[model samples]
Target: MRADIDGLPVRELTGLEYASIVEGVSVDGEQSPIMHACGHDVHISALLGATRLLAEHRERWSGTFLALFQPAEERAGGARKMVDDGLDVRIPAPDVAFSQHVMATPAGNVHACLGPSFSTADSIKVTVFGRGGHGSMPHTTVDPAVLASMIVLRLQTVVSRETRPGEFAVVTVGKMTVGSKVNIISDRAELQLNVRTSTSTPGPAC
Candidate 1:
């Protein structure tokens, strides 16, 4: 498998020491920036395991098998790049391609679905625009902090009260940052949201 242009940091998975070099001070704590909470390491490990299994059973299968350990899945365009890089032509195009994910579900139970099983996930960023003014004057500014709060709460309604019951929909404002400190009415605010789906309720079609 080819490597990513900017490969994922292995130190994110296995880091021995925290450095205090020229870059910046490294804080020591149980919580570290390099974490496998998203499970990318698990994915790579499983790919290796699958490769070993396929190698061991090489005699059983007759047709050619193309094993790809692709990258940039978080960006949602890695598979397309591999295809554009002649993945299907140089390697004999297989009749079907497959990928598997392990999620927080009922223990000891495995399940699979067909026809657009997972929903397309994407990130949404919203920047609330406002006017800045002195903290003493209450009505002088647009108060983007309040507007950002309204946006977050209103987005939730799009999923719960708006979307169809069977159709799965989610709009979440995961992070919000406004004023740096007290006594300052910030002029702008930013929010980041992560959205997800299943075959029972597919997102808008491309």
Candidate 2:
């Protein structure tokens, strides 16, 4: 199963405000501009506070609240998968859902989307298979290592050559695995990629 919350740092409780007081530790860390830093802790704190308020003021609203702490945004499609896995059936699906991300937008201000909320994403893997052989042999077998390397470079052109400029898309080859030994060429090579888009456009989804 996909993780509940995606893109969030591992320290889940770090986002809570009273966590520091309860745990008797400091929440703030050294500041860095281009780093994994933000006011997410405070925002998460406010969310918790809101939940507390709702629980306390149970009669204030006559509806049930499903406060979801989701995961796997960095991997993409987790939200949709959650919905598919009876998230709506087990809990309650709303006409619309909302989410907020820190560090994507500027500070000192809150951002919201109206129509098209955010980009969609898909993950894919490409495997190239060939015959393995000793390093000293040249024509004895097909070298998938070479072919996979070539495919890796060729994939780069997919975004540049195949995809037009400003098409709001990305194709990234994140992993490549070939042979295990130095003297023997591998029989197969694999490539893992994550693609992103700002619309319903679909590529090869893993």
Candidate 3:
């Protein structure tokens, strides 16, 4: 069992009152707003429910259960950190590992996929360099925000123009960090991208 505790640094969009109340999350001393855009909260709740049920009704089950609580799925390092902390030596290795994800579906419906249910994902960070200057002066400064915007637009064509017609690919600029103040132009812009490569085939219908 695994749960990702980290949230994306995105503003809350839901008007519901049960939305995330956390103000900001700090990463490497820099603080930024965050929200649970991913379905990690559902995964964590499911894991907790399963654990409680198994514990409360031990007689209904027989085998040992190992609950692995993990964090930093956004950084993609939680499992690796656990392994590095000697997870193998801490307990007996299970016969198999199981992972479940929550997805939107019809009520009371459960769906599963054979082979790779999700595409291969990759994360990339790119910093667009520029020359910072006062906002009052336009021509003097090379705005990285402008550069970032152009790069992001160009990245959109990577899948459409480069990939084969039958194949599938994606490029997304998931996160971008630019100038802090409206009156100042930043010297650099940080960009985080999540790219997925499709792994589907034209299979026979049922």
Candidate 4:
């Protein structure tokens, strides 16, 4: 068995005092605050529980068990690192292994089954460009606020309307910032989008 001891690079906005006290992540020369937004803590806790229970009941079973707690799952490959570090020789190579996860749901329940449950994560940062001018002048400049709104709306249809039914995919526009003041027309807008999917879909045309 294996559990991921990793977290995502997200700002902790829970308003709780015990939130992430550390700074964010640095990727490709960019930095952002980080948190355990992906429920990796719960996974690690479960792994500890299982290890303790089995250790206390060693007389009940005759089979071998291997528990692997790994880090850097959010990056490229943590498992490969484990293997290269002599995991196979340090522990008995078992025939099968399993892992579980906790996802955000209304019920807040835990479920487990065969097959794939998690999706690949792909994120992008985009800066929408437009012309800036006075707010009172309607025809003098291109309004990026309106254009950005349209782009956000159209991104929703990428998974819902274009992708085939029963396919697993999600496109989320998590952040957007535009304009400076009420009377100033902003020239640009910034957006952060995260994608999870098993297939690709068409993007909106600007």
Candidate 5:
């Protein structure tokens, strides 16, 4: 069994009944509030409970039980990093692996399926260059903010118009960084995009 032990950099809403009161600094040295917005906390708790139960009733199982706790799952490189760091040589490989995720379902219900349940994800960073100048001199500068905005608007068509009906795909421009001040245009803009598709095969839209 495996559990991803990472939290997203999201701030909890005020007056939330179960909101985490703890706050921590990120790797970028920005002090902010952090919470398990993806419910990895539940995953950790569930895996811990299962590990204890399986250990207490070891005679019921015939094979080795490994509880893998992975970090940096939100960044989408935790498993790869573990494998690169000699995870295969460090531990015994299993015949099969099992993992679970918390979904927005009923509290006491469990859902299982045979086929793929999650989509393959990809993160892309795109930078667009421009000439920086004062905001008042619009003609003197090539505004990358406008260019980035156009790209963001056009990327929506990738999922809506370009993708065929019934195909599961998502294109999200999660973050866009442009200028630092209101009166000056920046030299460049960066866009962080997240793409998700059900199949691993390359498609025309995704």
Candidate 6:
């Protein structure tokens, strides 16, 4: 069994009855609030409890019970890091494996399904280049901010028009950085995009 133990770099809502009070410095050396918004805390706790129970009743079962506590799952590099760190040689490979995630379901309810239950996700960063110049000189500069905006608008059509009906696909431009000031046009603009597609869906959804 495996459970992710990473927390998201997001601030909790104010005026909540059980908001996180702890503050920590992030990997970038900046102070930020941390919260388990993805329910990885619940996953870790559940895995610990289950491991304890199985340990106390080891006589009832026969086999190795490896409980994997993963990290950096929010960035999606935890599993790969573990493998690179010699996880394969340290632990025995099992015939079967199980992992769980907390979903938006009612309490005391557990869901299980065969085949692919989760969607495939990808993160992409795109940078468009242009010519840096003063905002007053419209003819002298190529504006990458405008190009980035055009790309964002065109990406919306990938899901709405290119994707077939009933197919599950999402294309989101989460972050865009352009010029620093209104009077100046930057030479380059950066875009952070996230794409998600259902595993069961056929063809390229995005």
Instruction: Using TM-score, give the best candidate's number.
Output: 5
Q: Model 5, 1-206: lDDT tens per residue?
A: 88898867788776778777778888668787887767887988889999999999998988777788998898888999999999999888676766567877888999888977888889999999999999999899999999999999999899889777877899999999999999999999999999999976555763
Rank candidates by lDDT, best first: 5, 6, 3, 4, 1, 2
Query: Could you tell me every candidate's TM-score relative to the true structure?
Result: 0.68, 0.63, 0.80, 0.58, 0.87, 0.83
Candidate 3: give the clashing pairs: none
User: Of the candidates numbered 1 and 2, which has the greater lDDT value?
Assistant: 1
What local distance difference test score does each model get?
A: 0.67, 0.66, 0.82, 0.80, 0.87, 0.86
Put down candidate 3 lDDT per residue, 118-156, tens digits, no spaces. Answer: 677889999999999999996999999999999999999
**What TM-score quantifies how close candidate 2 is to the native fold?**
0.63
Model 1, runs deviating above 4 Å: 1-32, 80-90, 105-109, 113-116, 197-206
The Cα error of candidate 5 at residue 162, in Å, is 0.6
lDDT of 5 at 104: 76
Report the C-alpha lDDT of model 2 over 125-199, residue by residue, as the tens digit. Answer: 889999988999958989998998898888788778876565667788877889989999888899888887785
Query: Of models 2 and 5, which has the larger TM-score?
Result: 5
Regions more than 4 Å wrong, model 2: 1-3, 6-50, 56-62, 71-86, 106-108, 112-117, 199-206
lDDT for 147 (candidate 6): 90
lDDT of 2: 0.66
> Candidate 4 regions off by >4 Å?
1-37, 47-97, 103-110, 200-206
lDDT of 3 at 6: 68
RMSD of each: 6.7, 8.9, 4.3, 6.4, 2.8, 3.2
Give the TM-score ranking, best first. 5, 6, 3, 1, 2, 4
Q: Model 1: per-residue lDDT, tens digit, 49-164?
A: 76788889998777665556776776567889889998778876457655567676785677776665657677887899998776888598998999999988888887788676
